[model samples]
Target: REMLVAEIEKRLPAWEKKTHLKCNGWQTKIMQNKWGSCNPAGKLWFNLHLAHTPIRCLDYVILHELLHLKVRHHNKDYIALLDKYMPFWQEVRKELNDFVLMPMK
Candidate 1:
């Protein structure tokens, strides 16, 4: 968890500086249908399953939610912002979606 937070902090500086956005905190937990979620209040959470995926995938999820802090919906403006920050975000998103995690049972 500490490592993940560190990575988030590292990746966040430029975005935060550029957009003046801030994230209060984050955590990880088992999620059935989503890799992450963010609220208007700036709190973020990641699916515990992300621990097993590639670091870039985790970064992708974090960035996705962080962008939500600025853009409330997946509209054109939101997508343009994502493209500006993470140019290949669509490819990264596809990789994340294509990844298969075994069922907990």
Candidate 2:
């Protein structure tokens, strides 16, 4: 948990610097089918499953959600922002989706 928070703190500033978007708070919790989510109010929730993925994958999820703070939908502007910030996001996303973890008991 602490490691996740530290990773988030390290990445948040750089994204905020690039996009001028700010998040007030963030936390991690178990999620069934999503990597991360963000609200317009600047709060973020990252899936605990992310800890199992590569660090780059985690960063991709973080940037993906932070961009959501700016654009509410996955439209052209959102895609453009992602392309601009993380050009390899699609690859990372594919890698994330392809990764499968065993069901927790």
Candidate 3:
């Protein structure tokens, strides 16, 4: 958990410069059907499965939800935000889908 936070913090400047959004905090826990989730209030959660993913892929998920702090939902604004910060995000997403471990719901 601490290591993940450090990685996220290291990437924060890039996210801020590109998306101009802030993330309140982050946590890792078991989740069945989610890679990550975000709330309008700036909280973000990640599936513990991410601990097994490549660092770049984890960054993509973290950045994806952090961008949601500025634009909720997978609408144009959100996609645009992701595009600006992570051009290769779709590739990462695909890799995540292929490799993610599902937890009991």
lDDT tens readout by residue for model 3, 1-105? 677667766776576666667778767778888888987678888877777778988888878888778777899988887887788889989998898576644
Considering lDDT, where higher is better, how would the candidates rank from best to worst? Answer: 2, 1, 3
Error of 2 at 10 (Å): 1.6
Best by lDDT: 2
Clashing pairs in 3: none
Return the clash pairs for model 1, or none: none
Q: Which segments of model 3 are wrong by more than 4 Å?
A: 1-5
After TM-score superposition, what is the CA distance of residue 88 in candidate 1 from its true location, in Å? Answer: 0.6
Clash counts for all predictions: 0, 0, 0
**What lDDT does model 2 reach?**
0.86
Better of 1 and 2 by lDDT: 2
- Which regions of candidate 2 are displaced past 4 Å? 101-105
The alpha-carbon lDDT assigned to residue 56 of candidate 2 equals: 91
Q: State TM-scores per candidate.
A: 0.81, 0.89, 0.81
